[model samples]
Target: MSNRGETVNIAIFTNSYLPFSGGVPTSIKTFKNAAEKLGHTVIVFAPSYPGHKSNGKGVIRIPSVKAMTYAGFYLPVPFSTEITKAFRRYDFDIVHVQHPYLLGETGMKMARKYNIPLVFTYHTMYEQYLHYLPVAESIANPVMRKFTTSFCNHSDLVIAPSEHVKEFLSKRNIETSIKVVPTGIELRPYRKKFRKGSIKRKHRIPQASKLLIYAGRITPEKNLKFLVKCMAKIAKKDPDVMCMLIGKSAEKDHYEYDLKDIVKREGMEDRIMFIGDVPHDKLIDYYKEADLFLFASKTETQGLVILEAMAAGTPVIAVDAPAISEFINGKNGFTVPQNMLKFTAKALSMLRDKKRMKQMSSNALKTAKKHSAENMAKKLIAEFRKVKPTQDEYENMRSLKDLSEIDWSDVIKKIMR
Candidate 1:
């Protein structure tokens, strides 16, 4: 580690970054900004996006190709000489990687080559998102687990956003020192004041109508179809209830079309509104205007969006999943099984109780306070200090596996042909 009181140089590697708006990018930005405030020198290494200008500060965007399977996401062009030389020049004290995909492997090689301590953050539950790929579900899940286990095992330490994620790594037999680090949010934005009736009036929603908001990308893993189905039941019982989805999908033509079809087929078009992606600064206003926030996704590592809603003083109604269960409960928010009947009933009950909603809103604000960015940065700095590079450890060729031994040539030929 650096001499006492000296700032440690950190290089964070990821498949995506700015000009892209999603959970991963948001997490990187949050941690990067917070870490810098604590006097740490940090730089981001991410894939370059076409037609977007990257501010040449502490970030390096490497050349990559747009992935065919996933929209607006790029896969780094393998074996980039520029990437290899860039790492050699920076000589980062620690290499932090967000995912265990292609760029991540390069990070591992560089870390080992320089004898730098490496850390991996388990950000997403890849098994739950096999539908996004063209591969067969049965084949993809086991491959994902195997790949994740290998990548995590090679790291000096692993960071899990919540205990739930740590437990998942444990279950998968990821033999690495794991730390629970919840990605903290900047609480200042949520604390700001916004025009009270702006969102409602802009959409022309009824003043008395109970506005239930869902904020995030519209995707299959988000279980938006289920939410729409539940809303259909709630609308029948209370016609004044309005469910507004406040984000757009990366593949808007695909996911958005499917969701709109559900709304029309159920004959609840007027009650369900797709208010496409609002500006991040204005997101707090949407949350503040909402009566209750609803999330059905079970694949979140920490559900940062739920915490953002809580910070905006909105109670949530979510599916009973690990990350969300950490803060959401009877006092702050409600969690129900994935059953449509039970979820619809609980949502309707919460909407009907004005006194209970007020109580839950107060509780949510308290919960949000416990997850400040300052606290998260301090915890991360402590972990960074603990990770010392062992002398002569990298010289042990047995501990570090050679990429050549894996029959990649044969596998690539068979798969590509």
Candidate 2:
């Protein structure tokens, strides 16, 4: 075997995948793409959603008996028989699970039944999901902690996307091997050029305006209302300050255009611009066009967009939270103390200082260089090599019973008849 190690096939399982348009989906795509480039065969199993396509190449959609459809897409519950059966035939060397709960649990089972080593990447803190699940913290927190710890402990390796998440995983007392590997950026040779000219013309952002760009989904966990609130405060002081709210909204009433209503009601509409979801291919243009990037989300295992903005030579202004604070330590960008008013004022300070803007751009570019796909691939490849199918388990998996003997004809007859 080459010193880089023998190429092993890996199957990744997640709740959502590409063309779904979210940070997690994008990170999943990036890893799959990078893994493939490293000569490892990679495939994913995810649900088909609206405006989402599954070519069925390297992807198998799970059938759900019960689903919660939203925006024309259905979320499959964990351990759907289709998923369990579909995975059995794949014969992967390793199963890497992303996200938590149902689908992740399915991955856990596959690792056991198929004798494949498993790895789990903890991408989000489900602390926010408890309220959505309508469960009290006393009940939900323990459950979340239990599942998280259990999942990590089951894995051959648990990859944390940020130092903050690694620490979080450690605190839960997950005894598995843990590694911190960043979701990397595909650095462009002419990326700096993409920054200098793209933002100014494409978005109609005036050269005189101090553009503050925010990327990613306009979701609740982002803590975006404060961004609007901060914009209003900044608008009160400087009319030339323009806040461009990019990305698709998660909730119509609670998240999106309503923010515009708030801005208009406050007579601050002129200062804040809501530009919905920018396509991935042209995202670099938006970064290049902006003078500074503003990210206030308290929820992130790692903010890939923050690195993207920095890659475009745009400094980020983010709340001092987890992954955000880990990558930015007052060197490449400014970190606010999660105080809304303070964040607004800190953003406001960037307006009058042209020299500081230029310095931050250089610093951002310098810091962003550390987060590249090659670096991440090295770490991920190491983890993949550390895991192997054992003699007994491998033999047992090959002898495991197939679902065909279970007689699913009754269920099919009931559904069709």
Candidate 3:
């Protein structure tokens, strides 16, 4: 640890970052900003893919020799041990691992070798990932659960984004100390533009058209096909009703193309538009312009978009899952059953009802102001300080794993000192 009295230096390991706008990437971005604000230095180690560009703010981009995307999911082909070697040299105070993938695994090994306290944040539900791997759920879910549980077990502290995730891990004996820190959003940017803004005109969206928007990756797990299916019905009911999807396709450009083809086939092409990717600063515009926010995915561990949309003053129409329900309620948005037709009907019903629609928008903005990234970062820093080893605990972390190998009296004296 640096002699710089309580100043923290965190090395964050994540599979993806900006140029990628899903739950995990966004969380890192916000957390980094918050940490810096709290007088801490944060360095992010993430995958360097096609759209990823380094901002040069202590974040190091480790490029993948090869990377591929399928159906909007990005997979970085496992690469060199150069990262692990460098991490040992950095000697960071804490190593926080975001995902349980290749980068995280390498970081974990480095943490053990270097005697650094390791913390893990549980993000996605990989058990639901079996279907995407082209494996049967019966065979895939157990394997995925095992992998995730083992990853959590290795950490000194496990930070779960929700109570449900905490419960899931505890049921399986991930006995590490756990903290339920709901992911926080930075509200200043979104809340400042509470009323309608120039985002509609900037996107060539006509004033009379009621814009329905979905701002996320165009992936199967996201269940975007249902939104395309509903666009036809929404268009029939209100010709002025326009559905716009503003998100980038990671490795899943083909699936995105298929959806575009669906629009052309349904003759609903002109009614829907796709804006592949945009800068983080500009994303608030889409959220600001939407009359209603729609997310159909039940696969998310926590639907950050639902909170983001509500923060941007747009009401959400989401599936009734724990992740969705945790932040939203009847006062702020509508929750529909997971069935396609029901989802579509609920989305349309919310959009068409002007009085109820306006009220939800108000409730959404109020709810969103509370989830700022600054607040979340503050909470995380507090937790890191709490879980960090005391003089005695540090001795244990620095000692060999085998209890029999240590000089007990000398070690305890050093710890007491």
Q: What lDDT does each candidate get? A: 0.82, 0.72, 0.73
TM-score of each: 0.91, 0.84, 0.83
Cα displacement (angstroms), candidate 3, residue 127, comes to: 2.9
> lDDT of model 3 at residue 344?
71
Clashing pairs in 1: none
Put down candidate 1 lDDT per residue, 167-286, tens digits, no spaces: 988997777899999988878787676888788898998877788899998888899999988888888889888989988686688888989999999999999999987877888899
Off by over 4 Å in 1: 3-5, 78-91, 390-417
Error of 2 at 109 (Å): 1.9
Which candidate number would show the highest lDDT if scored against the true structure?
1
lDDT of 2 by residue, 301-377 (tens): 99899998888888888888878888886767888887877887787777677788888889988777787765777
Which of candidates 1 and 2 is the stronger one according to lDDT?
A: 1
What's the lDDT for residue 82 in model 3? 51
Which 10 consecutive residues of model 2 have the lowest summed lDDT?
398-407
Candidate 1, residue 351: lDDT: 88
Clash totals in order: 0, 1, 7
RMSD of every candidate to native, in Å, equals 3.1, 5.6, 8.6
User: Which lDDT value does model 1 have at 329?
Assistant: 74
Candidate 3, residues 1-417, lDDT tens digits: the string is 444347787888887776666788889988888879878889888777666565568777665433222333444433556566556556588888897756776567666666677789988877765444433678657656766676676677899888777877789878789998777877767645434647667667688888888888777777777778777677766788888888877444477888898888878877888877767677787887788888778776678888888887789988777777777788899788777678777777787788998899899987777777877777777777766532223235332233232232332333233
